[model samples]
Structure formats: C-alpha cells, structure tokens
Target: MSFFTSNRFQDRQAAAAEARKAMAEKFLSRPKYDPNDPAVKEREAKRRAVLEARAAREVERERRRAEAAAAEAARLAAEEAARIEAVRQEALARDAAENARRAEEERLEYERKLDRDARYAARKERKKKAKSPFERYR
Candidate 1:
C-alpha cells in the first residue's frame, strides 16, 4: 500500500514539469518597468539633489580645513620671528656691555702711561738744572 494512488515514475515527472511551468508563468506575469514613469524620474531627481548637497558640504569642509591650516602656520611663523628677535636683542646688549668694559680699560691704561712720562720729564729737568749753570762756563 502507498500514500499516492499513481506512484509511477512517469506520473511524478509530469507533475514536476507542471509545477516548474506554473512557477515560470507566475514570474513572467509581473508588469515591466518603464523609464518614462514620473515616479522613477522623481526618485532620480531626489538622488541627484542629495549628491549635490553632499558635494557642497564636502567643499565647505575642505575650505575650512585649509583656512585653519594657514592660520596655524601663520601663528607658528610669528612665534618663530619673535623668538629670533629676542635672541638678536640679547646678543646686541651683551656686545654693548663688552665694548663699554674694553673702552674703560683702554682709557685707564692711557692715563697711567701719561702720568709716568710726566714724572720722568720733571726728574730730567731737575738734574739738568743742578749742573748746567757751572758746566756751561767750563
């Protein structure tokens, strides 16, 4: 005894073929798409608008980033210039102090030399006057 009345191999093959044809007919019965449909045009327009908005936003973001980078570079350059100026001023001040010290030393040395020469001249004049009045007649 079997569950099906006609459990023959030919009967099973015929039933399977009918089922496949029915499935293919069902798949082919749906309406085809039309490119000229208003709904499709509206969807495409919406997608284009979204893409444009996204591109505008990206351009604005890039502009802001470039401005920020330029500002940072300017700030760093200003800081470096200030630092260099400070170093230059300090060096000039140190050189001025050294020159002043040198000038003072040279002035003191000149005065000492002058004083020694004057003392030697006065002693020679005194020795010459002590013997000159009598030695001239001889």
Candidate 2:
C-alpha cells in the first residue's frame, strides 16, 4: 500500500488477484458438508421440524381468518335483516296512519252533509206552518 501508485492498472490487477486467492483459501479451509455426518443429520432434522411447524402455523392462521370472515358475514346478514324489518314496520305504521286520516276526513264530510240537510228541513217546516189552512188544502 502507498499514498499513490505510478501504475494504476497494475495495482488494481494485483489487488483483484490477491482478493480472489484470499476468497478461495477461505472457502477451502472451511469444513465440507458430508451427508453421513451426525451433526448434519441432526441439523437437517431440526430444519425439517421448524419448516413443519411454520407450515402448521400458516394453516392455523388461515383457518382463523376463514372463521372470522364467516362470523363477520353472519353479523352483516343479521344487521341487514334487522334493517329490512325496521323498514317494513315503518311502512306498516305509515299505512295505518294514512287509513286513520282518511277515515277521519270521511266522518267529517258525513257530519257536514247531515247539518246541511237538517238546516234545509227546518226552513221547509217553518214555511209550511206559515201557510194558511186553506192554502194547505189547495
């Protein structure tokens, strides 16, 4: 290493070769994987167990989600049914109110008709009494 290098390309190529050799030596010094090793077999078993546990947890989570969805759907259905029932009840109440109002109007109209007829009959009776006895015979 120097503060500066006269040949930059040579310095770069040497550094690259040294790095490659170091990497190769590091890989070669490490213990190689042997399928028959007890430690390797134990690690594989542990990894398989962990993978199985993760799969079971995922399945459980999915099942819970489905149950929650079903519950939510039932709640929404109940709310909708209640809303429809309320609307039906309100409509029935409105119909009943309308019927009562119509009946009241009819009753008032009949009363007015009766009053008019009574007034006309009284005026006819007075006129008949005012007439002479001979006029009544004629």
Query: TM-score, each model?
Result: 0.56, 0.79
**Highest lDDT against the true fold, candidate:** 2
RMSD from true fold, candidate 2: 3.5
- Per-residue lDDT of candidate 2, residues 55-96 (tens digit): 999999999999999999999999999999999999999999
What is each predicted model's overall lDDT from 0 to 1? Answer: 0.93, 0.96
Q: Against the true structure, candidate 2 has what lDDT?
A: 0.96
Tell me model 1's lDDT, rounded to 2 decimals: 0.93
Tell me the lDDT of model 2 at 61: 100
TM-score of 2: 0.79
Deviation (Å) of 10 in candidate 1:
24
Q: Write the per-residue lDDT of candidate 1 for residues 1-138, one digit (tens) a residue.
A: 688587899999999999999999999996577778898889899999999999999999999999999999999999999999999999999999999999999999999999999999999988877767678789
Question: In candidate 2, what residue range of length 10 has the lowest lDDT sum?
Answer: 1-10
